[model samples]
Target: MDSINVSELVERLGSDEDAVRKMAVFKLQGCVLDPSFADVFILEDGLTKLRHLTLHATGNTLAYSLTSFSRLLEVDKGWEYVNQDLVERVVELVVTHPLVNILRGAMSILVFIVSHPYTASNRISQPDSFGFRALQPAMTVYPQFLEMLVSRLSSADHALCANALLLINSLMREAITNDSEADWPKFIKQLQDLDVIKAVYTLMQSTALQDLSHPLIEFQALTKVLLRKWRDVPVDLNKSDHRRALKSIHLASNPERVTTPVDDGEEGSKKRHNPEKWRRLGFESETPAWEFEEVGYLGMMDLTEYVRQQEDGFPKLLLEQSTKLSEQRCPIARASLAVTSILCEHFEIEKADVDDAKIQLSFESRTNFDKVFKPLILQWSLLHTAGLQAFFRLWQTTGAETEDFMKIADLVRILLEAVVGGATRVSDVHEVETEIQQFELARLRHLQMELLELTYEDHWGHHLGQMRDELDHEALQFVKEQRIRCLLAGAWFSNGHGHKSDNVAVAKQDLNPSNPTSQRYAKLAHNRRFLHYADFDVRDDEEPDLEGLVEKIDLTTVSSVVLAPSEPSSSTTTLKATHKFISTRKVTIYGYLLANSRPASPKIHPRMGSTATKTPRKEVTLLTLHPQTQSLAAEWLDGLLMLLNYKPITDETKRLIAMVQDYGLKIRLLNVRFDDMALAGDSPEIPSREGLDEDYYYDILGN
Candidate 1:
């Protein structure tokens, strides 16, 4: 590879043959890789020739030179020369065409100019240039170079904006790692500038998750020196949040990872939001090791904001901007919901954070749910529903994940709990109903005034009153319908406490929300329409389990038939209808059924997808415990039998108890009362008692 003469290389740039010009530039750039060679290159007006070609270069030529420049800057210390006039002209060209033209070599020039050590450092205390001289003149012009980049970032094509982010990230990664922290504050301030933040966010907003590694990953890293409380960060959570979110490939700083502390919580710890507790919210037992860049975490935080807007804000421009970007509702639904569900158990998230934006931040943007719920619950509800739809869409699109099922359980419990709590909160249920009707009318009147008009000239007062009256009637209808449903559902689950951290019963449900059985129980118990794909056994005319289960009798060799199956059919199996046995809280029995019987009346035909094998297989049928046997179930089962007043297990019930355990109901329990009444009254602590052994009991898992 013989290098070409610099002057001849300069002239050949305009040669009729593109390959010749490309080869010439490639050879010239290769020669310039040495810092010593920069002087010679500058000697023959080489920069002028390079600039000429940059303005007219085809992708192949430009890509070669631009890539060469990035490499050259890594080594060369003397090539930061551009005549004042030429630098201004080129910088202006980049600023103007940077946004509109993706392949016009503007990015290449910015890359070249910004690579100089002058503009690379923050304005204050810039130590030196590439060659180690503190040349104030060179430093003076540096701001202009960044200004050009900022302009491009603010108004460029989305892809170009992505490139601009790449440029900044590249610089940031290197500087944060090796450079002194003296100028870090200014640099970070620059980073948060609207121009810069918008560009980075747009790139993140546009990237396909399948290709999360493209460019974003290449530049992925944590700003080891953050503005607030950078110290004492949990290394594992940092590593996990980063890996799961960013899929980061490069880290600027290899900060030592810290072990998340495990706290054996006491009464005081339970009252506070604990980091250890958040880790406990992992869909499973342990936090798996995964690392991601800070950018991914930041992007996810933004997603929470998007959720807030979708659920409560509904700003016309924010939505319109999203549409213009063609995001296809992902930000509204999946991205935000993923964070919300995770954050529900994620560290630092208090219930207060949900509306105030403390954990995820939006309060400064002025939309805290708790503070403004009375005025904006409906507006927020609309956005929340929109966000919920997006979450479903995202999860559906991604196929089922382990966490997906757990999240499902949490969300369902939350939904039901909200309804139940609303029902129980006010005394004099009928008056509460009347007030709800009035509230609906007031809300409707407010909406009418905003969306349409009760014009002043056209019977304004009368028209306004009519609209209010009409909605008032509709409000009454809504309250009536809600009351019927909530009355039934609330009494069943004992209201919103189901989703609370202290709610033992529903919290247990969170472990397996997506399980087909749980979904089945939820639908049947609530009498909500059949949920996605569920299969439940509801038989009460005879014995509940035997009624729906198909039983086969083989008088030949079989002494008894048993069954065990789980989830829906292999595909498209819907939960069978389940009828509730009672309107009030019924003490359903669970544990071993010691009774000896001949005909398991409704011969269980066996659930469709049996985990049991062929031949004479023992079966496990999931059934509700009858009130008569509930006490016996409690006696026979482990601590799982808390709800029922029953005696201890007897030898007679051991076999039946083992059968019940397989269906996943051996949960921790206590005698703490969490019925709907508890929610409307004062929050009281349960008195401590020497808990029964875990072999069958708990210390109040009350929510």
Candidate 2:
């Protein structure tokens, strides 16, 4: 379609006769699909003409006009012509239009506007831009829009249903990308309120649809966002309402497993015996040892070890049943597992059930249940904060009243009590004192084991009794130590800070301790009294001694912690020179308390017949943590960061801190806070302000 043809059709769009206008719009819809048609249409001012049709035109005229607009808007530059008024009219059409074609056309225009990268970016950076203005009414009337889409998901028209799913998928993708950190949780809650999950799940199960892939993909995406939102939002343990909110979005129950009959042919036999297929289904391969040797040494060794480990028929059966319970291929099953994985990740479980199924299925079994459930019970007893939150989220999501899940629930309650008790013990002090000593490790161990063993009368009980009888001192001691560490770390990070005596030793490098950095310590010139009054005095001969002063920073008042720049002389030196002069690693602690100048003595000096001012002045304090070793500096830096950045005072923070501590302890670091620390030498240099105007400097310097 040339510009001349587009201009001719556009002129006919304003004709007095209704038939001529309708024919012009229908033909223009096809023309607008051409890339060059948008420019000529814009030049002809066709958007303004289409805006009129959208508001007044009905039936095919409105639909075709919308189609033309939708196509024109596909061009990146076309968004500049869209305005808030046109968007409102299209949204109105979406709400009041009776024909499915008109509604879909309007929605298609919206989808193009919203999902465009340029428009989505502008939504945040330039809220008053055309794209954002267009989105306002659509967002305002989103509830009705969502309802319409949900209703269309159940429509008998396959094309309408698919379009609805496509629109929904696009909207969700945009929401996840753009609004994830903003209003994503609210958006997710809205989806739940409308039962979009139920509708989508129903659509997935519909056999009338020739291909289930599109709906399945949409369902998976929805599940991903829900799981992501749930993980992002922490649940308050103290609030019953917060815990109850997790149960609001119930996923469809897991589909029952059914065995399909096999054909009595060579192909059927090959399918039944396929090792790769068995592995994909989460089962042990039936391939022979010779076949394993054909792979390689590493593969053969791995298979050999796995096969040897599952020698017992009972254990093999349990593994097979557990694998079946997880059900990898089903979309609903994968979603359920994802929910479980999110719970596990939040809880800080050491080994989460990612794609592989674990012993979780054992909890559902009644026959020889204790044997199956014992390991998991013991593992849960030693869980970190993340693990506990995982368990809590799982308990809430499943709403399971089963004895096994109840055990997790009970563990959560007990852990909460421990946290509260820890907090209560330190409520009187500014910092944790003897609370670590006060916590009876043995009693806590016994309590945890008691809780974990409550549901198990057979295997766990008998196993403990046998171990006691055999006097397995080393094994029992190991378990006791692990349980104590888990409980104490969980409780301490949840409520208590480190011990008051737990100060990290550091050296002050910016100024010598013997000569205080405070200006108040500077000697005053008695001869120049006017200069002293003007705060510009020369130093006197006699300097007040501050040789033995010791500086100690109380970390509780620290507002920010930042790494200080390392000296270029040390960092850029050759290997031998670098060894000779080791770089001094430092971290700056900013706090109001640290800003107070050192107090001067009231006693007069005999030589000058005067005393320095006793009053302290407030200034920006830069207390650098200078440790002898890099690792020591990293340890303190990480600890201060974790301390300063900790907020919201929720159970989730407790679990995370506990997880860090647990991992650090396992690795045998100096402290639990030694995460990966970036060297200040590697940081980018700040841009110098040499070319700035004098006024800019004055503004910055507060002149």
Worst 10 residues of 1 by lDDT: 555-564
What does candidate 2's lDDT look like per residue over 1-703, in tens digits?
A: 5435777777888888888999999988887767776777878888778768866788888888888888887765467556676677777776666788887788777767666664467767656444333465665865486676667777776766776676666666666656635465566557657777666655544454343344434445345444444444443424454433221211111112344456664343222222233333222332222222222222222222332333453233334444543332222112222224433443333433322222333233333222211122111112222232334344444443334443444444454345323442113221222332243444544465554445332334554355444444433334334433332221101101111111122112233223212121211122211001111123334433323113334333333444554322312211111111125454444432212343223333345322323453222332443445544444444433433332212233334445544333323222222121212124546789888867643345555
* Alpha carbon deviation, residue 249, candidate 2 (Å): 16
Candidate 2: where is the Cα deviation over 4 Å?
2-4, 118-143, 180-182, 208-216, 234-339, 342-703
Clash counts for the predictions, in order:
37, 7
Per residue, candidate 1 scores C-alpha lDDT tens digits across 1-703 of: 2455666776786678889878877776667666656566667766666666655665567655554544444564324443344344444544444324432344544444444544444334434422212222433555464556655555435556555555565455445544554454356556556355444434343323122223333332232123111222223444455454322211111112345444766433223333322122121213422211222333344343453444434333233323432322222223333433432332222222222222222222222222212211112223234334434443344444544554443443233223322432112333432333233323433333332232221324454455455554444344334333432231112221122221112212334332222111111223332111113333223322323323222221111111112222222221221123222212221111112322232222245321222232222222322222332222212222211111223232344333333222112111222252244445657887677555865588778
RMSD, each candidate, Å? Answer: 26.9, 30.8
Which number leads on lDDT? 2
Candidate 1 lDDT at 423 equals 38
